[model samples]
Target: MNSKKRAWFVLGITIIINILCQEYFFTEQFINFNPGRHNILYSAPYFVIGGLLYLYRKEIHNWMNIIGGWMLLFCLVLNIGYFLLPISDLLGHSLFPLLIVFTAYHMYALGSDKKWLHNKIIDFLSGISMEIYLCHMVMFRVVERLHLENYISDSNLNYVVTSVLTICLAICFAYCVQRGLDKLLLKKIA
Candidate 1:
Protein backbone atom coordinates (compact mmCIF):
# COMPACT_ATOMS: atom_id res chain seq x y z
CA MET A 1 0.00 0.00 0.00
CA ASN A 2 1.10 3.53 -0.72
CA SER A 3 1.74 5.14 2.65
CA LYS A 4 1.14 8.61 1.24
CA LYS A 5 -2.25 7.53 -0.02
CA ARG A 6 -2.91 5.81 3.28
CA ALA A 7 -2.17 9.07 5.07
CA TRP A 8 -4.72 10.85 2.90
CA PHE A 9 -7.30 8.15 3.64
CA VAL A 10 -6.70 8.46 7.38
CA LEU A 11 -7.03 12.24 7.15
CA GLY A 12 -10.30 11.82 5.32
CA ILE A 13 -11.62 9.42 7.92
CA THR A 14 -10.70 11.76 10.77
CA ILE A 15 -12.31 14.71 9.02
CA ILE A 16 -15.49 12.73 8.49
CA ILE A 17 -15.51 11.59 12.08
CA ASN A 18 -15.03 15.17 13.29
CA ILE A 19 -17.88 16.42 11.12
CA LEU A 20 -20.17 13.66 12.32
CA CYS A 21 -19.27 14.32 15.92
CA GLN A 22 -19.88 18.02 15.51
CA GLU A 23 -23.24 17.39 13.95
CA TYR A 24 -24.26 15.05 16.76
CA PHE A 25 -24.24 11.78 14.90
CA PHE A 26 -25.52 9.91 17.91
CA THR A 27 -26.97 10.52 21.37
CA GLU A 28 -24.48 11.36 24.12
CA GLN A 29 -25.18 8.22 26.17
CA PHE A 30 -25.02 6.04 23.09
CA ILE A 31 -21.81 7.38 21.52
CA ASN A 32 -20.46 10.84 21.95
CA PHE A 33 -17.07 11.78 20.52
CA ASN A 34 -17.27 15.48 21.41
CA PRO A 35 -14.97 17.40 23.74
CA GLY A 36 -13.28 14.19 24.88
CA ARG A 37 -9.79 12.76 24.58
CA HIS A 38 -11.25 9.98 22.46
CA ASN A 39 -12.32 12.65 19.99
CA ILE A 40 -8.99 13.07 18.23
CA LEU A 41 -10.85 13.72 15.01
CA TYR A 42 -10.01 17.43 14.99
CA SER A 43 -6.30 16.70 15.21
CA ALA A 44 -6.51 15.10 11.80
CA PRO A 45 -6.00 18.44 10.08
CA TYR A 46 -2.61 18.88 11.67
CA PHE A 47 -1.65 15.37 10.68
CA VAL A 48 -2.72 16.11 7.14
CA ILE A 49 -0.40 19.14 7.01
CA GLY A 50 2.49 17.07 8.28
CA GLY A 51 1.68 14.25 5.89
CA LEU A 52 1.76 16.62 2.95
CA LEU A 53 5.08 18.03 4.12
CA TYR A 54 6.42 14.49 4.51
CA LEU A 55 5.39 13.60 0.99
CA TYR A 56 7.05 16.74 -0.30
CA ARG A 57 10.05 16.50 2.02
CA LYS A 58 12.54 16.34 -0.79
CA GLU A 59 11.13 19.42 -2.46
CA ILE A 60 11.28 21.70 0.60
CA HIS A 61 13.24 24.86 -0.06
CA ASN A 62 13.68 28.18 1.72
CA TRP A 63 11.33 31.09 1.08
CA MET A 64 13.41 30.98 -2.04
CA ASN A 65 11.33 27.89 -2.47
CA ILE A 66 8.12 29.85 -2.15
CA ILE A 67 8.75 33.55 -2.87
CA GLY A 68 11.92 32.90 -4.88
CA GLY A 69 15.34 34.51 -4.41
CA TRP A 70 16.24 38.27 -4.00
CA MET A 71 13.23 38.80 -1.69
CA LEU A 72 14.84 36.63 1.04
CA LEU A 73 14.49 39.25 3.83
CA PHE A 74 10.74 39.46 3.42
CA CYS A 75 10.39 35.69 3.54
CA LEU A 76 12.68 35.45 6.57
CA VAL A 77 10.63 37.97 8.54
CA LEU A 78 7.41 36.20 7.65
CA ASN A 79 8.73 32.78 8.59
CA ILE A 80 10.28 33.86 11.89
CA GLY A 81 7.26 35.92 12.92
CA TYR A 82 4.97 33.06 12.02
CA PHE A 83 6.70 30.81 14.56
CA LEU A 84 7.46 33.44 17.22
CA LEU A 85 3.92 34.82 17.46
CA PRO A 86 2.77 31.43 18.67
CA ILE A 87 4.96 31.79 21.76
CA SER A 88 2.42 34.15 23.37
CA ASP A 89 -0.08 32.14 25.41
CA LEU A 90 -3.06 34.02 24.05
CA LEU A 91 -2.32 32.94 20.49
CA GLY A 92 -0.23 29.92 21.38
CA HIS A 93 -2.79 28.14 23.54
CA SER A 94 -5.65 29.01 21.23
CA LEU A 95 -3.92 28.13 17.94
CA PHE A 96 -1.61 25.55 19.43
CA PRO A 97 -2.23 22.76 16.95
CA LEU A 98 -1.96 25.06 13.97
CA LEU A 99 1.12 26.64 15.50
CA ILE A 100 2.40 23.12 15.93
CA VAL A 101 2.04 22.56 12.22
CA PHE A 102 4.04 25.72 11.60
CA THR A 103 6.50 24.66 14.27
CA ALA A 104 7.29 21.37 12.57
CA TYR A 105 8.22 23.14 9.39
CA HIS A 106 10.07 25.85 11.27
CA MET A 107 12.19 23.30 13.09
CA TYR A 108 13.05 21.62 9.85
CA ALA A 109 14.02 24.93 8.30
CA LEU A 110 16.08 26.09 11.25
CA GLY A 111 17.80 22.76 11.73
CA SER A 112 18.82 22.69 8.12
CA ASP A 113 19.89 26.34 7.98
CA LYS A 114 21.78 26.77 11.26
CA LYS A 115 24.31 24.53 12.96
CA TRP A 116 24.01 25.78 16.58
CA LEU A 117 20.22 25.70 16.26
CA HIS A 118 19.98 21.91 16.51
CA ASN A 119 21.47 20.70 19.77
CA LYS A 120 21.61 17.28 21.41
CA ILE A 121 19.13 18.37 24.09
CA ILE A 122 16.64 19.35 21.42
CA ASP A 123 17.14 16.07 19.60
CA PHE A 124 16.67 14.08 22.78
CA LEU A 125 13.64 16.08 23.89
CA SER A 126 12.03 15.92 20.47
CA GLY A 127 12.60 12.18 20.36
CA ILE A 128 10.61 11.67 23.56
CA SER A 129 8.28 14.66 23.31
CA MET A 130 5.18 12.49 23.35
CA GLU A 131 6.39 10.68 26.45
CA ILE A 132 7.21 13.98 28.17
CA TYR A 133 3.74 15.26 27.37
CA LEU A 134 2.05 12.11 28.69
CA CYS A 135 4.22 11.81 31.80
CA HIS A 136 4.05 15.51 32.66
CA MET A 137 0.27 15.52 32.88
CA VAL A 138 0.36 12.65 35.37
CA MET A 139 2.96 14.49 37.46
CA PHE A 140 0.87 17.65 37.43
CA ARG A 141 -2.19 15.67 38.51
CA VAL A 142 -0.20 14.18 41.41
CA VAL A 143 0.95 17.61 42.51
CA GLU A 144 -2.61 18.88 42.43
CA ARG A 145 -3.90 15.92 44.46
CA LEU A 146 -1.24 16.37 47.17
CA HIS A 147 -2.20 20.04 47.52
CA LEU A 148 1.32 21.03 46.57
CA GLU A 149 0.02 24.25 45.11
CA ASN A 150 -1.71 25.26 48.33
CA TYR A 151 1.19 24.34 50.61
CA ILE A 152 3.23 27.50 50.28
CA SER A 153 1.73 30.81 51.29
CA ASP A 154 4.20 32.69 49.10
CA SER A 155 2.54 32.74 45.72
CA ASN A 156 5.32 33.41 43.20
CA LEU A 157 8.07 31.19 44.60
CA ASN A 158 5.69 28.37 45.34
CA TYR A 159 4.33 28.39 41.85
CA VAL A 160 7.83 28.56 40.40
CA VAL A 161 9.08 25.73 42.56
CA THR A 162 6.16 23.53 41.72
CA SER A 163 6.50 24.22 38.01
CA VAL A 164 10.23 23.55 38.07
CA LEU A 165 9.83 20.34 40.03
CA THR A 166 7.07 19.14 37.77
CA ILE A 167 9.14 19.73 34.64
CA CYS A 168 12.32 18.12 35.99
CA LEU A 169 10.51 15.05 37.25
CA ALA A 170 8.51 14.79 34.08
CA ILE A 171 11.68 14.78 31.97
CA CYS A 172 13.29 12.15 34.16
CA PHE A 173 10.22 9.91 34.10
CA ALA A 174 9.70 10.30 30.39
CA TYR A 175 13.35 9.51 29.65
CA CYS A 176 13.22 6.35 31.74
CA VAL A 177 10.02 5.20 30.11
CA GLN A 178 11.41 5.85 26.63
CA ARG A 179 14.56 3.92 27.44
CA GLY A 180 12.58 1.02 28.78
CA LEU A 181 10.37 0.92 25.72
CA ASP A 182 13.41 1.16 23.47
CA LYS A 183 15.11 -1.79 25.16
CA LEU A 184 11.98 -3.91 25.26
CA LEU A 185 10.80 -3.22 21.72
CA LEU A 186 14.08 -2.61 19.92
CA LYS A 187 16.96 -4.33 21.69
CA LYS A 188 15.02 -7.52 22.41
CA ILE A 189 13.84 -7.76 18.81
CA ALA A 190 17.32 -7.14 17.52
Candidate 2:
Protein backbone atom coordinates (compact mmCIF):
# COMPACT_ATOMS: atom_id res chain seq x y z
CA MET A 1 0.00 0.00 0.00
CA ASN A 2 1.00 3.56 -0.61
CA SER A 3 1.93 5.93 2.22
CA LYS A 4 -1.34 7.83 1.97
CA LYS A 5 -3.34 4.64 2.22
CA ARG A 6 -1.29 3.52 5.21
CA ALA A 7 -1.84 6.87 6.90
CA TRP A 8 -5.58 6.64 6.38
CA PHE A 9 -5.62 3.13 7.75
CA VAL A 10 -3.72 4.17 10.83
CA LEU A 11 -5.98 7.17 11.32
CA GLY A 12 -9.09 5.02 11.11
CA ILE A 13 -7.76 2.48 13.58
CA THR A 14 -6.66 5.15 16.01
CA ILE A 15 -9.99 6.93 15.85
CA ILE A 16 -11.83 3.67 16.62
CA ILE A 17 -9.44 2.94 19.46
CA ASN A 18 -9.90 6.44 20.82
CA ILE A 19 -13.65 6.09 20.75
CA LEU A 20 -13.58 2.71 22.42
CA CYS A 21 -11.15 3.85 25.06
CA GLN A 22 -13.11 6.97 25.87
CA GLU A 23 -16.47 5.26 25.90
CA TYR A 24 -15.94 1.89 27.56
CA PHE A 25 -12.46 1.64 29.02
CA PHE A 26 -12.47 4.79 31.11
CA THR A 27 -13.86 3.22 34.27
CA GLU A 28 -12.62 3.68 37.82
CA GLN A 29 -10.64 0.45 37.60
CA PHE A 30 -8.99 1.62 34.39
CA ILE A 31 -8.29 5.01 35.95
CA ASN A 32 -6.61 3.34 38.89
CA PHE A 33 -4.58 1.12 36.61
CA ASN A 34 -3.58 4.04 34.43
CA PRO A 35 -2.96 6.79 36.90
CA GLY A 36 -2.62 10.38 35.70
CA ARG A 37 -3.99 9.44 32.26
CA HIS A 38 -0.47 8.48 31.35
CA ASN A 39 -1.35 5.39 29.38
CA ILE A 40 -0.32 5.46 25.70
CA LEU A 41 -3.69 3.93 24.78
CA TYR A 42 -5.40 7.11 25.94
CA SER A 43 -3.07 9.54 24.19
CA ALA A 44 -1.80 7.70 21.13
CA PRO A 45 -4.78 8.60 19.00
CA TYR A 46 -4.35 12.31 19.61
CA PHE A 47 -0.68 12.06 18.71
CA VAL A 48 -1.63 10.19 15.56
CA ILE A 49 -4.21 12.82 14.68
CA GLY A 50 -1.73 15.61 15.22
CA GLY A 51 0.85 13.82 13.08
CA LEU A 52 -1.66 13.31 10.28
CA LEU A 53 -2.66 16.95 10.47
CA TYR A 54 0.94 18.04 10.03
CA LEU A 55 1.54 15.48 7.29
CA TYR A 56 -1.29 16.68 5.08
CA ARG A 57 -1.34 20.28 6.25
CA LYS A 58 -0.98 21.77 2.77
CA GLU A 59 -3.81 19.73 1.30
CA ILE A 60 -5.95 20.44 4.37
CA HIS A 61 -5.15 24.12 4.11
CA ASN A 62 -6.44 24.30 0.55
CA TRP A 63 -9.56 22.36 1.49
CA MET A 64 -10.06 24.66 4.45
CA ASN A 65 -9.89 27.72 2.22
CA ILE A 66 -12.72 26.31 0.12
CA ILE A 67 -15.04 25.34 3.00
CA GLY A 68 -13.59 27.20 5.97
CA GLY A 69 -16.53 29.54 6.60
CA TRP A 70 -19.12 26.78 6.50
CA MET A 71 -16.94 24.59 8.66
CA LEU A 72 -16.58 27.37 11.22
CA LEU A 73 -20.35 27.84 11.33
CA PHE A 74 -20.88 24.14 11.77
CA CYS A 75 -18.35 24.00 14.58
CA LEU A 76 -20.03 26.97 16.24
CA VAL A 77 -23.36 25.22 16.07
CA LEU A 78 -21.86 22.07 17.57
CA ASN A 79 -20.32 24.09 20.38
CA ILE A 80 -23.59 25.88 21.11
CA GLY A 81 -25.53 22.65 21.03
CA TYR A 82 -23.04 20.92 23.25
CA PHE A 83 -23.11 23.67 25.85
CA LEU A 84 -26.79 24.73 25.80
CA LEU A 85 -28.54 21.43 25.22
CA PRO A 86 -29.17 19.17 28.19
CA ILE A 87 -27.15 16.24 26.96
CA SER A 88 -26.16 13.31 29.12
CA ASP A 89 -22.56 13.01 30.21
CA LEU A 90 -22.12 9.76 28.27
CA LEU A 91 -23.52 11.28 25.08
CA GLY A 92 -21.37 14.35 25.42
CA HIS A 93 -18.28 12.30 26.15
CA SER A 94 -18.94 10.07 23.15
CA LEU A 95 -18.93 13.08 20.85
CA PHE A 96 -15.67 14.37 22.27
CA PRO A 97 -13.45 12.80 19.60
CA LEU A 98 -15.36 14.34 16.74
CA LEU A 99 -15.76 17.66 18.50
CA ILE A 100 -12.08 17.91 19.35
CA VAL A 101 -10.93 17.03 15.82
CA PHE A 102 -13.27 19.50 14.18
CA THR A 103 -12.43 22.24 16.68
CA ALA A 104 -8.69 21.73 16.22
CA TYR A 105 -8.98 21.74 12.43
CA HIS A 106 -11.06 24.91 12.40
CA MET A 107 -8.74 26.64 14.85
CA TYR A 108 -5.74 25.81 12.70
CA ALA A 109 -7.44 26.96 9.49
CA LEU A 110 -8.84 30.16 10.96
CA GLY A 111 -5.80 31.08 13.00
CA SER A 112 -3.44 30.54 10.06
CA ASP A 113 -4.42 33.84 8.45
CA LYS A 114 -4.53 35.91 11.64
CA LYS A 115 -1.48 38.17 11.96
CA TRP A 116 -2.17 38.69 15.67
CA LEU A 117 -1.40 35.03 16.30
CA HIS A 118 2.22 35.60 15.30
CA ASN A 119 3.18 37.86 18.14
CA LYS A 120 6.48 37.63 20.03
CA ILE A 121 4.88 36.33 23.21
CA ILE A 122 3.08 33.59 21.28
CA ASP A 123 6.28 32.64 19.51
CA PHE A 124 8.21 32.47 22.75
CA LEU A 125 5.51 30.45 24.48
CA SER A 126 5.23 28.04 21.57
CA GLY A 127 8.97 27.47 21.63
CA ILE A 128 8.93 26.58 25.29
CA SER A 129 5.52 24.89 25.47
CA MET A 130 6.97 21.41 25.95
CA GLU A 131 9.24 22.71 28.67
CA ILE A 132 6.36 24.51 30.32
CA TYR A 133 4.29 21.32 30.26
CA LEU A 134 7.15 19.44 31.83
CA CYS A 135 7.67 21.85 34.73
CA HIS A 136 4.22 23.36 35.31
CA MET A 137 3.21 20.85 38.01
CA VAL A 138 6.41 21.57 39.91
CA MET A 139 5.75 25.31 39.68
CA PHE A 140 2.22 24.81 41.00
CA ARG A 141 3.55 22.79 43.89
CA VAL A 142 6.11 25.48 44.64
CA VAL A 143 3.37 28.12 44.66
CA GLU A 144 1.31 26.02 47.07
CA ARG A 145 4.31 25.37 49.28
CA LEU A 146 5.09 29.09 49.44
CA HIS A 147 1.54 29.72 50.76
CA LEU A 148 0.96 32.53 48.29
CA GLU A 149 -2.78 32.04 48.70
CA ASN A 150 -2.74 33.63 52.16
CA TYR A 151 -1.55 36.96 50.75
CA ILE A 152 -4.90 37.55 49.08
CA SER A 153 -7.93 37.44 51.27
CA ASP A 154 -10.49 36.91 48.53
CA SER A 155 -10.64 33.29 47.44
CA ASN A 156 -11.41 34.07 43.82
CA LEU A 157 -8.69 36.73 43.58
CA ASN A 158 -6.25 34.48 45.36
CA TYR A 159 -6.92 31.64 42.94
CA VAL A 160 -6.47 33.92 39.95
CA VAL A 161 -3.32 35.52 41.36
CA THR A 162 -1.74 32.19 42.22
CA SER A 163 -2.60 30.72 38.83
CA VAL A 164 -1.08 33.67 36.99
CA LEU A 165 1.99 33.63 39.23
CA THR A 166 2.42 29.90 38.76
CA ILE A 167 2.18 30.24 34.99
CA CYS A 168 4.68 33.10 34.99
CA LEU A 169 7.10 31.12 37.11
CA ALA A 170 6.66 28.12 34.87
CA ILE A 171 7.40 30.21 31.80
CA CYS A 172 10.56 31.64 33.33
CA PHE A 173 11.71 28.19 34.41
CA ALA A 174 10.98 26.73 30.97
CA TYR A 175 12.85 29.55 29.26
CA CYS A 176 15.88 29.04 31.49
CA VAL A 177 15.88 25.27 30.90
CA GLN A 178 15.60 25.72 27.12
CA ARG A 179 18.43 28.24 27.10
CA GLY A 180 20.63 26.02 29.25
CA LEU A 181 20.01 23.03 26.99
CA ASP A 182 20.81 25.09 23.91
CA LYS A 183 24.08 26.28 25.43
CA LEU A 184 25.02 22.79 26.57
CA LEU A 185 24.33 21.34 23.13
CA LEU A 186 26.28 24.16 21.49
CA LYS A 187 29.26 23.52 23.74
CA LYS A 188 29.22 19.77 22.93
CA ILE A 189 28.99 20.48 19.20
CA ALA A 190 31.80 23.03 19.33
Give each model a TM-score. Answer: 0.48, 0.61
Model 1: how far is 80 from its true place, Å? 11
Report the C-alpha displacement of residue 122, candidate 2, in angstroms: 1.6
- Across 1-190, the per-residue lDDT of candidate 2 in tens digits comes to 2366677788778767766876668667566564223456656666566656666778777776676467667667776776677657766454454547554654565436445658898888989989998898789789888886567789988889878988999999999999999999999999
- Tens digits of per-residue lDDT for model 1, 1-190: 1477777787667656655655555447666444533344555556565655656565554532454333444445656776676556555343344535464554355325444546898788878878987788688666656676567878888778878887888899999999898889997788
What range of 10 consecutive residues in model 1 has the weakest lDDT sum? 63-72
Clashes of each: 0, 0
Q: How many backbone clashes does candidate 1 have?
A: 0
Runs of candidate 2 exceeding 4 Å displacement: 1-3, 22-24, 28-39, 66-74, 86-111, 130-170
Candidate achieving the largest TM-score? 2
Give the TM-score comparing model 1 with the true structure, all chains together.
0.48
